[model samples]
Target: MTGTDGLVVGEEVPEFSAPLVAPDADREERSLSELLSDGPVLFCFYTADFSPDCIEEWCSFRDFDWFASTSDVQVVGISKSRSWIHQQFIDYLDLQFPLFSDRDLTIAEAFDVRYRVFGLFERSKRSCFLIDEDRTVRYKWVGQHWLDPTRDVPPVTEIFEGVRNELGAPETETFGFDAAMTD
Candidate 1:
């Protein structure tokens, strides 16, 4: 399917590589297979690095308590921003995940989430994909419209719950604070 239609659940995501800025500020090319090698992955696609919505979405992922508690899943971000911009953004937010630089929107196009904003500038629609070890998409979420004032990031808690139900809980919950403490 074309990028406008976006990928669907059960579709196998093709392996691709892109330049990325790691949390430690290293810039290098990384492939999807390398990421999947660790386990399942949650790919968060956004319009730009410093946009308000992008910041909010990434901060949520950075502070996601479930992420700290789970070693079975890795979360990374993709955007059209350059590697240096991604480094600054990651440092500004203290993000725990790497950010891929899809400056030409090639990766977003492959995922079918690339769109032209105001019918001019190319950008990635806010989207998320839960891809398993087999490279098959298990879950997908895309924002209704980039210009929609109400559009926001997908709910991390709900995604975490779905992952738990599908993959079962990790054997040990060594990270994150006690859930009871939040109550």
Candidate 2:
């Protein structure tokens, strides 16, 4: 499980800290390092929120509602929307995940998702990343920002079976050893 090409899979993921707003919190700041403390995380980036495709994509993640129990994976959607805007988006859509505001594109750039839209408009191309417990981006996909994300989360296998396999973390609670606390 390692980052490849421009994305690092086995190395430490680039760290960027910025203000983030959860469904209930205000303009609170959360860093990449902080988010990785608990375990793995899935980051879904798009042009913006409230767009038909974007909203539908979020709804799908919310509907799955399985990351909480299935793995250490926590889903976070990143976009140029303001924290307040994210709050409304989350509230209106009743998303059960966190949405991070990357208005400055710092986080987006760190993940190499930030770029000019159509070579003119500034925005993050629709992209998805699978970060391992060590914050390494083990999987990534960018392009087709307009595709129907309502269909599934990228790296679909992880969405269905959890990231333990992708990250090479053995199943322990049920398979035998504790997945976490192991080297």
Candidate 3:
């Protein structure tokens, strides 16, 4: 099968590089392998940059504090949108994470999240993958349309909890105030 078919858990992220728009709007090239050099990565592939659902999803990631709670997990957004569009999204949202331009769809295809409808509309599916420092897939989720028959992507807190648990770390209620009960 071609890369379009996607990869499964335990698979190594493909050796691929692409242009990314940093939070500062600086353009740079990054390889999946190179990112692994730092630590585990959360590769979040979404349909379109400015789409409402995508905005909501990513903004949640932006507001979530779990990434800071973990020492080495890097989050990256991927889409077929151009670098300028990615830059615009970052600026508009004041996002803290970097977004990469999957212009060729190579990264999406390798992750098996590329979706094309009737040879017309082509984009990456709303998917998330947690790849460890060794480049092995740790967790993954592919989303369906949020309207009907929703695929129900896991909440940020759940993703954080899972990742933290796997890393052998203590868990905290991400958004809940356990302290309120003690008051």
Candidate 4:
């Protein structure tokens, strides 16, 4: 069930699909169940691509060591940006994770994170969710305001800890940002 404010911990995320931009810049249609099949998934919903805060947030994810170390949990980002924009953002930041293009905000709306900025522009609130293979949300954090540095993104360390605690420790070593660069 959804919380009064939005999706809450323990609720099963609704099924959804979107165009995905892989780190290699390949684009394809991906569904939530398909993603969960690999393992737990972290869905980070940001406003748009290339904005200063967005750049910083994604860079932080790119630099976080835990993400690079883990193979059992997939970290994916979503936003209202188009597939091409997502590709550009990934290439520009050299992001190691896949991103979803929710151009119509359908995914955000399903998660109840869609909101209007200044009562004008429709955008997804900065939010993050850790959903297990069973599709149950284990952790959820939603930002309170737009452009508020204090609330724009959830703490990376906290997300790391949540993933560890919810999905168990990483089972295998994998390439991180540095490895991605050399390849």
Better of 1 and 2 by TM-score: 1
Tens-place lDDT digits, model 4, residues 38-130: 988999999789988888899888887667566777899999999999988999988889999999888988888877765678877888899
Choose the strongest candidate by TM-score.
Answer: 1
**Segments in model 4 whose C-alpha atoms lie over 4 Å from true places:** 1-4, 146-151, 171-183
Using all chains and alpha carbons, the TM-scores for the candidates as numbered come to 0.88, 0.76, 0.83, 0.87
After aligning candidate 2 to the native by TM-score, how far in Å is the CA of 17 from where it should be? Answer: 0.8
Span of ten consecutive residues with least summed lDDT in model 2: 173-182
Inter-residue clash pairs, candidate 1: 3-112
Per-model C-alpha RMSD = 2.8, 6.3, 3.8, 5.0
Candidate that beats the other on TM-score, 2 or 3, i.e. the better one: 3
Over the stretch 111-139, how does candidate 3's per-residue lDDT look in tens digits?
87776654466677677788998888888
Q: What lDDT score goes with residue 168 in model 1?
A: 72
Over all chains combined, what TM-score does candidate 4 have? 0.87
What are the runs in model 2 whose C-alpha is more than 4 Å off?
1-8, 144-164, 167-183
The whole-model lDDT of each prediction reads 0.80, 0.67, 0.74, 0.80
Work out candidate 3's RMSD over C-alphas. 3.8
- What TM-score should be assigned to candidate 3? 0.83
